[model samples]
Target: MTETSTEGTGTIEALSLVPKAEARQSMKDFKSDQEVRWCPGCGDYAVLAAVQGFMPELGLAKENIVFVSGIGCSSRFPYYMNTYGMHSIHGRAPAIATGLASSRRDLSVWVVTGDGDALSIGGNHLIHALRRNVNLKILLFNNRIYGLTKGQYSPPRRSARSPSRRRWARWTRPSTRCRSPSARRRRSWRGRWTPTASI
Candidate 1:
C-alpha cells in the first residue's frame, strides 16, 4: 500500500500489510535429538522430513505444537519431532488427541496413525472426531499396512477385502514390505538363501 502526503514534501512510502512471522526456525530446529528408527527406505522418513521442513512456514512455536501417535510403525513419530508429543494407546490416538486439543485450545494437536492402528481398533474414535468437527490435523499414513507386528492383518486386507482376499489372507501369513525376498527366502539350501517371490 502507498499513500502520498501533500502537506509538505510529496512522498510515497511502501508498506507491507502482512504480519511478521512469529518464528524464524529452520528445518534443523524441528529435528529431535533422538535417532530416526524407521527402515532405510520407509515412506515415514519422507513424511517426517517434509513435516519438519514445512513447520517453519507456519511460524508457530514448537512448544505449542503437539504430535499424538498410536501403535504401529508410525507410533514412534513423536520421538523424532522436537514438538510436544504423545505415544498414545493402541488405536486410541484420535481419542487422546481430541481430549488434549479440547482441553488445551492453545495447543495445536496432530494425530499420526497408520491404516491398521486407526481403522481397526480405533475406528469409533476416528469417526467421533470427524463427526464432531473437532479442530485437529490428522495425518493418516495409509500405506494399507500394519508393519509393526507380523501376526496382525494389514489395513488393505481388513478394510477393503474381497471375499476371495479374506479366504486367502486368513490362511497366508502377513509379511512386511521392507523385507527383501532374499532375506525372507522360502528355504535355506547349502546354508545359503536366494530371492524368491513364491510363498
Candidate 2:
C-alpha cells in the first residue's frame, strides 16, 4: 500500500511501506498444502522445484514474498508455494506484480508466466514492467506450445506455417536469439539471466 503527502513547499510524495517478516524461513516452510497437479513430465514441475529450492536462499520471511502468475500450466505455481501469491487473469500477472512491487517495496515480488501468456496477451504489460525496471523477477516459461490448452501453437512456436501440417524446428540459426536482449541488459543494468535446461 502507498500514501501520498504534501509538504509546505507544495511538493507531493508517494511512499512505499510494507511490514517486513520477523521470522526465519526454510525450504519446507515455503511448501504449501496443495498437491502438484501438472502432467507427469511437464516443465513446470522442474521450474517449480528450482524456485522452491532457491526461495530459501533469499532469507526473507515467507509472508514477505509474493508470486504472481497468469492463466497457463505455469500459473498453477502459487498453489504449490506457501507464500503470498495470486493466480491472476490471462496475461495480466506482470501488471498485478507491478502494483504490488511499486506499492510494497519491502516485499519480494515474482511473476511466473508462459510464452503465450507473456508474449501474446501480456506483452504490453511485460514490456512496460521491464522498461520501468520494477523491483520484481519475471520467469517466462517458453515451452513453444500451449501446454495448458492442450498443444496449441504459441507465439514463440518455431514451426513452419503450413496449413496441412505443423512441425517443430529451430527458428534461428543459433538458439542464442533469446539470450541476446538479456545479455545486453546485463551489461547495462546488471540483470542476469539464469538459463535452465529445456524449461
Candidate 2 lDDT tens digits, 76-195: 899999999999999999999989888777777889988888877887787767655566677888877777777766766655567543444434432322344643352213332333
lDDT of 2: 0.70
Worst 10-residue lDDT window for candidate 2 reads: 6-15
TM-score result, candidate 1? 0.69
Candidate 2's C-alpha runs over 4 A off are: 1-24, 161-164, 167-199
Instruction: Kindly report which residue stretches of model 1 are placed more than 4 angstroms away from their true locations once superposed.
Output: 1-22, 158-199
- The best candidate in terms of TM-score: 2
Candidate 2 similarity to native, TM-score: 0.74
Each model's lDDT comes to: 0.67, 0.70
Q: How would you encode candidate 1's per-residue C-alpha lDDT over 65-91 as one tens digit per residue?
A: 889999988889999999899998989
Q: Report the lDDT of model 1 for residue 180.
A: 29
